[model samples]
Target chain A: MTASSSLDGVLAPVLTPFGPDLSVDEARFIRLARTLMDQGLGLAPFGTTSEGNSLSVDEKIGLMDALAAAGLDMARMMPGTGCCALSDSVRLSAHAVTLGCGGVLMLPPFYYKNPSEDGLFAAFAETIERVGDARLRVFLYHFPQQSQVPITLSLIERLLKAYPGIVAGAKDSSGDFANMEAMCTHFPGFKVFAGTERLILSVMRAGGAGCISANANIHGAAMLDLVRRWQEPDAAKHQTALEGFRSVMEGLPLIAALKAVTARRTGEPEWRRVRPPLVQFPVEREEELMERLKGIGVLG
Target chain B: MTASSSLDGVLAPVLTPFGPDLSVDEARFIRLARTLMDQGLGLAPFGTTSEGNSLSVDEKIGLMDALAAAGLDMARMMPGTGCCALSDSVRLSAHAVTLGCGGVLMLPPFYYKNPSEDGLFAAFAETIERVGDARLRVFLYHFPQQSQVPITLSLIERLLKAYPGIVAGAKDSSGDFANMEAMCTHFPGFKVFAGTERLILSVMRAGGAGCISANANIHGAAMLDLVRRWQEPDAAKHQTALEGFRSVMEGLPLIAALKAVTARRTGEPEWRRVRPPLVQFPVEREEELMERLKGIGVLG
Candidate 1:
C-alpha cells in the first residue's frame, strides 16, 4: 500500500493506556487499537494524544512490537516517530518503515526556537538520509503551538524538491485554516491531514486529506462519515455536531479528557493514568466533561 | 565536596564544537573544558550553550566520560541533564552522580505545556527517586523563555521540603531579575545562579550564588573578578564592562555569535559549526558582530 492510499481517511491519534505504576499497559493499548480498526479507523500511535514524547525509545518500540504481534495491518498505522535527537528520530522512523507502516508523522527538532529554514531542512534531510529507507514516507507534524518550531512552506518545498517520494504529506496542527488551506492549494498532490476534527469537513471540501484527531478515539465513525459525505447537502450539519463535540473536548485538558471518555466507554479506569508532566484529568473536571459530552449525545 | 561549595563562583556554560560533518568535536570540547578550569571556572556542560538537547544520549555520556578521563575535577562540574523524557533525565542525572559530579542542572520535563504544579513536582520526584543516589543535587533550570515551563517558587518550596538535599538551587534564565530576586529572598540558603553575566554583580550583592553564563565561554575572568569584588566600591565599574560585552553578544543569535568569537580568537574556524536546528553564523552578521565587539574592546 502506498502512503497516499493507505492513510487517506480519519486516523485516530490513539490514547496510550498506563498501569498504576505508570508503565505502558500494552495489552490495553493493543485492544484499543483493534477496537478502533474494527470501527474502520486508521491508527496513529505515539502522537501528542499518545504522550509520545514522554515515553522512552525502548517503551515506544515495545508498544509498536506489541501492536504488530497482535496481527494488526501495519500499513493502516502511521506512528509518530519524531524526537528532539536526530538519532532517535532516525531509529524510530527506520523501525516503522521496516515494520511496513504506511507513514510516520515527523516533528521538527523542537528544542531550539527560531531555527533557520536551512537548519529545519537540514534536520529533515539528515533524518531521511540516515534512515536510508526507500519506503519511508514522512508526514511533517507542524504543531507550532506546542513544538514552537513551525514547518514553514519553504522548508516543505525544499524537502519535497529533495525527496519527492519520501516527503509525502503534512498534518497542520497549527489550528489555522488559512495555513491548512495554503498547504492544500500549494501542494496539489501532497496529502494534508487536518489536525483537529472540527476542521474535518472544511479540510475535506478544500481538496485536502482527512484528519488525524484526538477526538477520533471516541468519535471516529462520525468523523469518517463526514469525510465520506463531505459533498452531501447536509454535510454542514455533521460538521456542526463534530464542532460541538470537539469544543467540549478542547474545553478541558485534551489528552486527559479523551482518556476519561475512553475509560468510561471501555469500563477500564486504568485508561485515566497519564505520565508525569501530565497529570490525570481532575475528578471534578472529568465529571463536568462527562455531563457536557452526554448533553451533546456523545456519551451515555 | 558538597553541592554548595563545589559549584560556587563563576561557572561557564561551555560551548560545544562540531566538526565539518556536525559530529561532536570531543577533543576540542575537552580542551575547552581544561582551559576553562585553568582560568578558575567551573564547567557546566550540556547546557543551552552546549546544545545539550541536540546531542544524543550516547554522545552526552561519551562527552562526560571524556571529561572524567582527562582528569578534570568532576566535583566542580554541573552538567545539564534534563530531557523531555523522564527516563532520559533519570539516566543522565544518575550518571552524573555516579561520576562524582557536584550537581546536575535539570530543566523540568518541558514537552507538555501548562502543566500543574503537582505534575511538575511529580516529574522531579520521579527522576530523583529513580536516580536513587544519595549525592544527587538538582539545580532547577528555570528558563521559561525557552522551556515555556517556569519553575515557580512554590514548586521549589515543595521540592525543598520533600528532598532538602537534592533540590539544591536554580539558574534563573528567565532574564527577569524580580523573579530571580524572589527566588533568592524567598528561600534563604538556596544556591541561585544568574543565567547571564550582566546580572552577575547584582546577583552576588543580593547574597545569591555567582552565575552560569554563556559569555563566560570567552570572558570568564571578567565575570570572576566581578564576583570577587561585588562588595567593593569599584564593583559597578566591572559590571558595566561585563554588561557591555553581554549586550553585544545578545544583539545576535547567542550560540552562533559565541562560536564566532571563539573561532576568531582561537584561529580555528571549526568552532563556528553548530548542529542542525541551528545554522552557522552568517558571514555578514559575524563581521558586524566582530566589529561591535572590537569597538567595545572585547575581542582585540
Candidate 2:
C-alpha cells in the first residue's frame, strides 16, 4: 500500500518517560504523546530521542499495545522499528503494521559497518518479504551520526525500484540539507523528511516532506507554525525562533535534556529518570538550562 | 566465583554457518565447535567473526542449547553476549551462565555514542546486578571500530571495583597494542585476551590471558602452536607466521573471507552463505584468495 498522506507534517520523535525504578512510565509517556497530538503534531515514537535501542523488544511491543489500548489513533503514528538484528526489525515492523499504524521508520541493520549496498538492499528486501504485509509502508530512518550506517541514495534507488510501493520515503537525520536536497531532487515523488526542524522551511520549499524532529517534543506548536507559514513573508522569523529553541535542547545530551525540561514543566520528577548508558541531566545543568529557557521566554 | 582456569588459551571466535535459506545451521555450528575443541582450542561463538549481532537472541540461545546438549564442555566456552539492548545482553549472558559456560564476552551498550563513564558504569552495574547470578563471569569485549564504544581502563577499573569476582577480564579488539599493554600492565591479575593472534606472543609474555582470533576458525592448530611456543626462543618466528596468515584473512572482509576459505576446505557450498548486511566474498576474489592461501602453503 502507498504511504498515508497524513504521514506528512510536523512530527515529534516523542520522548519516552521513565519511572523512578527506570521502567518505562507508560501513563506519562501516553500523556505526553496525547499532548503532542492535541497540539496538532503527528507522533513518531521510539526515534533516537526515545532511547529506542536502549529498550528491549518486549518493552517496545508493550508500549505500542498500551498506546493502541489508550484509544490513540494509530493512523497518526509512525514508530521507529529499525534494529541491528533483522529479526528485531521484522518483529517490530510487523507489530506496527498489524496495529494499522500509518508507517514504520526502518533503520538499515546498523551493527555491521561499511556493508555493501547490495547487502543493505538485501536486508530491506528480506524485512519486507518476511513481514509480507500489503499494508507495510516503510520510511527509512537515516541517522548516520547515531547509527554509523548511512542510507545511501543508490541503496534507496534500488529499494524503490524493487518495491515501489513499500519503500515509501526516508527521514534524513544526517542534518545535511545538501543530502536532503539531493534526495528531494533525485527522486521526485519520494518523501524526504528533515530530521531536524532547523531546515523545515528549506525542506518544505524544496518539494520535500515535513520534518520529524527531536525538539518537536517541546516546540511542536512553533514548528507547526513554521510548516503552515513556509510560504508567508514572515516564515524566516518563525524558522529563527524554532532554531533558537532547538539549540537549547541540543546544548546538552538531547534526550536527557528533553526529559529534564519535561520533568520541570509537568511537575513530575520521575520524568527526569533515564535508563543506563544514558544518565539523567546533572542537577546543576538542569537548573542552568531552566534559567536559560526562562531567559529566552521558553519557560516562565 | 572467580573465572575458571579453563578460560585461557587460543580461542576461536567461531564462525557461524548459515543454511541456503539463511537460517542458522545449528548442526553445522555444533560440529565446528567440536572440531575446534578437538584441535585443543577454546570456543568463543557469537563473536564478530561469528556474526553475533546478525543473529537474533532466539537463534543464539538455540545454538548454545544445541552445543550444551551435544556434551561440549561449557567450561571451555566464552560466547560473545553483547548487544545494543541491555535486556538482550542480559538475556544472552544469563543463558550462557545457566548453561554452565565459563565466561561471557560482554560489549557495552553500543547504540549511544560518547556516553559518560558514569553512564557506562551504570549500564554494566545494572546488567551484572540484574543477572544476579553468582556463576556469571564477564570478560569485557572492547572493539571500538565495530561497537564505537570503548571499554576504557577507568570504566574497567570501576566495574572491577563494583563487582570483583563477576568482572573477570577483557578481550581487547581495538587492535591497539598500547591500550592492550596498558590493560595488561595496570590490571595485574585480570585476564586480558589479545583480539588478534598477531599479538599472542606479546600478550602471553606480558602475563595476559591468551588470544581470541577469527583466524582460529580455520587455523586453530597454528594459533595453538604459537600459544604454546610464546615462551620458547622461536616465539618471535611463530608470531611472524601467525601475523602472515592473519594478514591474508584481513586482505578482505574478515568474516566473508574466512567463510570463503571454509567453503573451499569443507566443500560445503552453504558455508559461503552470510546473513544480510554481510555479503559473500565475490567468486573472483574467492579464487584469488585460494590461490594466495595455496601459495603460502596454507591450502592444499
- C-alpha positional error of residue B126 in candidate 2 after TM-score superposition, expressed in Å: 1.0
Give one digit per residue, the lDDT tens place, for model 2 in B1-300.
Answer: 277768798889999998866889999888889988999998999998999988888889999999999999998999988877777888999999999999999988888888899999998888888789999999999999999988899999988888998999999998888898898888777899999988888888888888898888888888889888788999898889877877787758889889989989888888898888999888788888888788776865
**Among all candidates shown, the one with the greatest lDDT:** 1
Question: What do the candidate models score in CA lDDT, each in turn?
Answer: 0.88, 0.87
- Note the residue pairs that clash in candidate 2: none
Candidate 1, B78: how far from true, in Å?
1.1
What ranges in model 1 sit over 4 Å off? Answer: A1-3, A285-288, B1-3, B284-300
Candidate 1 - CAPRI tier? medium
Write down the TM-score for model 2.
0.97
Tens digit per residue, CA lDDT, model 1, B152-215: 9999999999998788899999888888888889888789999989898878877789899888
lDDT of 1 by residue, A162-227 (tens): 998899999999999889999888887889999998898888878888999988998898999999
Off by over 4 Å in 2: none
Give model 2's docking category. Answer: medium
Specify the poorest-scoring 10-residue window by lDDT in model 1 chain B: B1-10
Clashes of each: 0, 0
